[model samples]
Structures are given as structure tokens and as C-alpha cells.
Target: MALYKTIGAFLLFLGTVSGYANPGACSGTCVNTHDPSIIRRSDGTYFRFSTGGKIAVHTAPDITGPWTYKGAALPAGSSIDLGGNQDLWAPEVALVGNTYYLYYSVSKFGVQDSAIGVATSSSLDVGTWKDLGSTGIRSSSGKPYNAIDPNLINADGTYYITFGSFWKDIHQVAMKNPPKAVASGSSAVQVAFDPVKTDEEGAFVFKHGSYYYLFFSKGKCCGYDTSRPAAGEEYKILVCRSTSATGGYKDKSGKACTNGGGTVVLESHGNVYGPGGQGVYDDPVHGPVSIRSRKTIWLIMLIIFALQILYYHYVNTKIGFADGQKQFGWNTINFSSGWPVV
Candidate 1:
């Protein structure tokens, strides 16, 4: 009877093994890329953007693609140089009506002197981009504030820009038209999560199921030895939701985001430091989804294996080995030594 029971368990294990495949396949780590932005066209093509003030086009029939890069959307000489500009970073792309707008920032890392600018393109295919110039948003010294990363979202026929970094606070500016300048007297307001000292950038806001979701990345970004690899140094993507676009956003634990409460939507799986610059797009195959580069899924799988091993030892010690042998649990394995494990 015991042998029969063991055979049955073995059969079940085989069935599970046959049904379960690897977690997912992702190329090892696409290096030299950070602050990724994605846009899906009506024709089922995807265009992605990064910090260098350039946009790259990738086409795929599905969202999870063998995404092939066509070319850069912004031309070589299209970069902007604001007062004492350093480098262009953190590009956010939005589509409204028939036009596509690319919002980007110019700043030195760790400096509040940053400026955000816009560029418009009627067709995202190849040529057709026109730089709409800067919005005159700057810091007190006539220099740019880190608070200038622009994230555009339209609500109720009116467009709103959520722009800010860690220096001051995240602010919202309303626009009468989509992808245009803010309305007169539309001063910025402190909204969503605020970081006391850490730099909070890449603020992306969207509406889902009557709830306005605020997604932001906080912590250090874009430096090799810049404390990102250490614990708490890792950048994480956090999320909060509210009924209104401006206030009452709360985490899953029901803590208000205004009080610095946030639920982590995504985090670095492994060597994927600062996997924060995110964008959402509508795919013909997967409906609405987000695309951002990170460490490959293989790293996540290794962590899962390590956790399973630790759990197996913990279960064997807590519960008697013989009793554990008969217990049904996830991914259980029975060894010849009468030890049952996961």
C-alpha cells in the first residue's frame, strides 16, 4: 500500500512537471539602457524611448515580442540644450487625439537644475517630429529644478501634467488642450507621494477601472557605484490609487499616499538596478500592459529555487520528517532517505 501511494505521488509529480514550464524567457540583461518608455501604435507596432533624447521603434504582432528595433524616432540633432544643460534623461511619451508628444528632461544627476521639454510627432513611423520647445518651467535661480520631468495624462477632456522630482514636490498643471501648455494661472500643486530626501522621478499617472493610479520610481538612478546595489539602495516602482487624479491615493494596506504610503508594484528582481522608468501601452494582443526593461527572468527563477530549498529545510525541522513525508505541499519531492521536501 505504501509503495502504491508512493507511485501515485510520483505520477502526480510527473504530471505537474509536464504541465509546468520555465517561468518566462527574457534576454540576459539589455545593457546600456535605462529609463524606458513605450508606446503602442494602432497598427500594432511599439516605439520605445530612453534618456538620450532619442526614440527607438520596435514592431511586434504581440506585446511580448521578439521586438525588433527599426530606428531612432528623434533625429541626431534634435536634442535640446537649456541653460547650462548637462544631459537629457527620463523621456515620457504620451499620445492624445492624433498627435504623439514626447516629454523629456535635461539635468545633471543629483542636481535640482533640470528642465523638461516637449516634442511632437504626427506619425511615429519615421520623419515628422517637431520640437515644440521648453515650457519655461525652472528653479528659483533661473536654473532647472529636478521637478521638471513631465508626465502627461488627460482627464475629462482636459490634460494634466504631473511633473516633479525629489527636490521640491510632485506638482500637477492642467492644460486646456491635450499635449499643450498649461492653462493660465494653472500653478503646480503637490500631489501623490512625496520623498523627504530621496529623489522621486518618473511619475506616470493613468486611470484604470474608475481609479486613478499613480506610479512613481523613487531612490537613486543612473550611477554605477551609486548605492543602488545595496539594500534600500535599490530603486523600486511604487503605486497608489485614488478616485481623483490629485488626492486620496492609497496603497493596498489602505495607507494614504499623501502620508508617504505606497505599495510596491514592481522591484528589481536581481541585478536589474533601478527598474523604474515605466510606461503603459495598449497592445492588440495583450490589451493594456506596461513595458520596461529589467534583469532577465532567469535571475528571478534562481531566487525562487533558493527560497524553495530554504523552505524545505525549514519544513523538515519544524515538522517531523516522517510526518512531512505524507503531507501534501507545493512542489514536493520524496527522497530515498524517507525525507519529503519542496
Candidate 2:
């Protein structure tokens, strides 16, 4: 009982420092998402698509989910010729007209040999997809910009996509009507680049009131097993905003996003590590929602719970331990400051 009290106190301290008790979003199977892009059905069900195994799909009845794995959005892999890995990375889902378009990335680890492909589905279910082929976007050996992590946006009906990494960070291109393809002869523009860190990608844009917010991830991701990661290497979510969707994004400190300016939205805290690869969805109930991936604290709790079970059985045990009750609750984080409290 004393050990449990200490653990609870430590968690409370961490939450006080981080300005959040727990993320008010969904958990359980709903929490295991990476580069997540979420969309809502007509029946109020939320479908979440993410990076992995040809684009994994999860669905839930509410935004706060008891998410269940459905299947891959793209089962056969990408039609793009530059593929070295069939496992898609960073899926962005958008509803255009009556159809849903899924944009995914194909790359060879850290190399610039990458392409963004699209697949269309009339319904968000398994085996209902048709690959729309590549968006004619690619990053070659000598190109300054990467052509992965595609995010489609509509600026007053004109479609555009923002994508890139490493070499020149984030770039935007004018997209054609259906948005599965780039506009003919439309030049890609350099939007957001980090001159200092040079480690920005997973760009997602959301328009709220008077500004278009550009959210990107910086530093290394997917290195969870490392003994102790450095501050700069751990994945964290950052944001900048622009009046126009095209350019001139700045952080809260009035620094240019091109010159390595970004305000941290979410970062590693306690057992929740490497939070990045985010997407924004406008919820009918919760208003605006941000989704991402992080190794959560509950895994650590489970391990501790198992150890407690062993301690109670074989070691010094608590009296009437079986009579102890556990309760779980939720507390929503306020995002009026343009970021989740953390």
C-alpha cells in the first residue's frame, strides 16, 4: 500500500509539471497508433488509419475509443516503382466529395528514394480499396526535398499537399482536384524547414479561425528500446502557424519556422515516450482533436501490477489486499493555447 501511494504521488508530480494528469483521448487498443489520420463516418463512427503493415486501420464508435483493429487500407502495397519497403509510413486520410483518399509513403529507411501513393475507398473497410497509383511525387538522390509524409489540405476548394523530410524538411505542392495527383506543371514550394535541427517531417496542417497551423515532428522516432535517449533525439510534436496556407509560419516566440522555429506541443513525459507523427481532426463533440503515437504509461503499470501480485504472494504482503479497489477516470486537456497542455 505504501509503494502504491509513492507511485501515485510520483505520477501526480509529473502531471503537475507537465500540466496534464492524463491525455483525455482514447486508450487501450485505441492508443497504439502511429502517424495516425482519423476520419468520421456518417453514422458517427471514427475510423483511424496509420503507418505500418500496408496501412493499418482501427475503428471506434466515439473519438474516445475502444478502438478495434479492422485491417489494412492497402493490402497489396503501393504501385509506385521506387519502393524498397512495402510497409507504408505516415498515412493521411481525407474525405473529398463522396470518396475517401488515403495518402501513404514508401521509402528505403533513411534514403531519399521515396514516393507518396494514394488509394481510394468508398467505404472505410477491408478489401474495399483501389490503389490510385502515385501522386507523381518522388525524392531522388540529388533532390533537396523528400517526397514522403503527404498531407492533403483544401484552401478554399484549391487542393494542396505538404510533404518532405531531412534534406529540405517540408515542402508544399499544388494538388489537382481529386487530390490523388499533383497539379500539372505546378511547382512545389518550400514551406517549413529546420536550419538548426534539420530533422522535421510528418507535417500536418489545420486551419483554425484566422491561422493555418503547421504541426511537424522533430528528432528521432521509433527508438523506444534505447537505454536512455537524449533530449534532442526523443520524438516530440511541434507547431507553427501561418495566416496563409502557403508560407510564413512562425512559432509563439516570433521565430521563422524555416529557420528552425517551432513551439513544442507534446513531448516525452513519465512512461509516455516519443510522442509524434500527429494528425488533427475536427470532432463534432470535442471540437478539435490531435492524434499521435507514444509508448504509454499503462504498460509500465501492468508490469508493476504483475510484480505487486508476486510480492503479495511470496514476499511481505498487504493485509486484506484482495479487498483493495482501483478506480480510473478521465480529465480533458485544454487546447485554447493552440496546443495540448503539456
Candidate 3:
């Protein structure tokens, strides 16, 4: 109980540091989530789609959510004829027209025979999801990229799905309309790569101003329990930007992202370790207000919850994800110096 309280206090401190207009913070009992993607409905309801429990669907009245699990989007698992369809991973949601499409990953750990699946919903409620099978994105042992961590981004007017894993880091491909699958005759383009075994993955592209910010997770991700991955080798969030969403992204040092260059957006700090599995969203009342689509006002709020498991600060020190299994966290993101500081 004391550990939980300490976690709460850190969350509050994070919000205070971010400098929100209201300085609202969140910290409570949170279930674990992997590769989470959150989006707000027209009614201001927030839906969080994540891995496990057949793409777990949790809804909340607010961003600092007392989130309530509604039901699995694919209760019986994906309709795709993949071997690990039952154990789907990396769910990314996109609202295209009146339909909400939820893209998921189908694979096991360390296996290259993987595919990205999709399902559609009109209301994002139980019994509303219709499986759409594969998005024609898959990877094999000989492939350079893995087909997990499906992140859909609407770059300018074109749609693209950026995904990959440890195999070759992150890759992007042009996506056609409706976003049920990749664009015809489109080939996967390498966007970001690390020469050192390429431990980066979980890529999310957010369009802020004239630049499209690409956020991704780097270093070892799972199976944490002391003396693992060293200290700096643990998972952390990194970012790069490109004028064109397809390629040519660079870090703050102006280093090309494809050549193992990335700027650290979020990393181990105090009690939060391996802080990754990130996505940026616009909240109507949190960070920076902007106009998205209609006349609705929105702010920037990022979801960076993928740590193995972190507890409270003990004796002025907090442990890393090597302590426990896994859990989740979210915080408001404020911009500074033309960078969306996560």
C-alpha cells in the first residue's frame, strides 16, 4: 500500500513538472498494458486498446482514468489464420470515417513468422467489432522487419502504417484509404534502424506542426528480473522527426534516424524505469491546445506505459522494471523549445 502511494506521488509530481493549466494528475491501481493506443470518441469517451485479453478494451470518462474494462475487442481472438492469433499483441486504433479500425499483431516472442491483423467497429463496443483479417503486413524469418506494433498515422493527407520489432527496428509503408491494408504496389521502407542489433520498436508518428514526430521504444523490452540488460539497456522512449512522414527522420543532433540516431524522449527517471510503449494524443484540456478536424479544442497527452513493473521510492531511490512483472502509466505532455517534451 505504501508503494502504491509513492507511485501516485510521482505521477502527481510529473504533472506538476509538465506545467498544465490545471495541473491535474493521475495515479491509482492500474492494470498492466502492452503497446497501448488510446483515442477519444466523439462524445469525449476515451478508449484504450492494448495487448493481452484478446486486445483488451478499457474505457474512461477522463484521461486520468478510473478506467473500467468493458470487454475484449476480439473475445475469441483474431479471425486471421495465424498460429498465435489467440495471443495477439500491439493494438493500434484509428478512426477512419464513421468506422473505427483496430489493428493488432499476431505472433509470439522472438518468432519472425508474424502478421498484423485488423478489425472494425462502428461504436467501439462489445459485439460491434468485425474482424477484417490481415492487413497484408507480415514478416518471416528472412524478412528484415517484424510485423508487430502496428501504428497508423495520417501523414498530411496520406495514411501509413509504421511497424517493426528487434529484427530491423522501424519501417513504414504507404497505406491506402479505409486503412484495411497496405497500399497496392507499396513496399516497406526503412525509416529508422540501429546498427547494434536494432533493439528499437513500437513506432508511433504524431503530426504536430510542419514536422511529423516519430516516437519509438528502444532497448530490451520484457522478462525483467535483476542483472538483465544492464542498466541503460532497458526499454526507453526515443523520438525523431521528418518533414515527410515516409523517411528522412533525424534526431536532435541532426543525425539520421536510419543510421542509429534517435533523441531520448522519455527514459528511466526516479521510480519510473523502462518507460516506453508510447503514443501521443491530443486532449481537449490538458497540454497544448490545437484544432484537430472540427472546431474541437485538443491538447497533447502521451501514453508511455510499458515498464516491466515499478513500485514506490524507497530510501530516496526507486527500482527499475527488473523488480516485478509489468504495469501501466499515463501523463500529460507539454511542449518546450519546439519539441513535444514527453
User: By the lDDT metric, which is better: model 2 or model 3?
Assistant: 3
- Span of 10 residues, lowest total lDDT, candidate 2: 307-316
Query: Which RMSD does model 2 reach against the true structure?
Result: 12.1
* Weakest ten-residue segment in model 3 by summed lDDT: 307-316
| lDDT ranking of the models | 3, 2, 1
- Local distance difference test, each candidate: 0.54, 0.70, 0.74
Model 1 global lDDT (CA atoms, 0 to 1): 0.54
Please estimate how well model 2 matches the true structure, expressed as its whole-model Cα lDDT.
Answer: 0.70
Residue clash pairs of candidate 2:
none
Show model 2 residue runs off by greater than 4 Å. 1-18, 25-28, 288-342
Residue 267 in model 1: lDDT: 47
Name the runs in model 3 displaced over 4 angstroms: 1-24, 27-29, 289-325
Residue pairs with backbone atoms closer than 3 Å in model 3 (clashes): 283-299, 308-326
**Any idea what lDDT model 3 has?**
0.74
When 2 and 3 are scored with TM-score, the better candidate is: 3
TM-score of 1: 0.69
The sequence of per-residue lDDT tens digits that candidate 1 reaches over residues 2-108 is 76455546644653466422212222122233565666787766565555425444454443444555655565533456543434666677788788887777666
Shift in Å, residue 278, candidate 3? 0.6
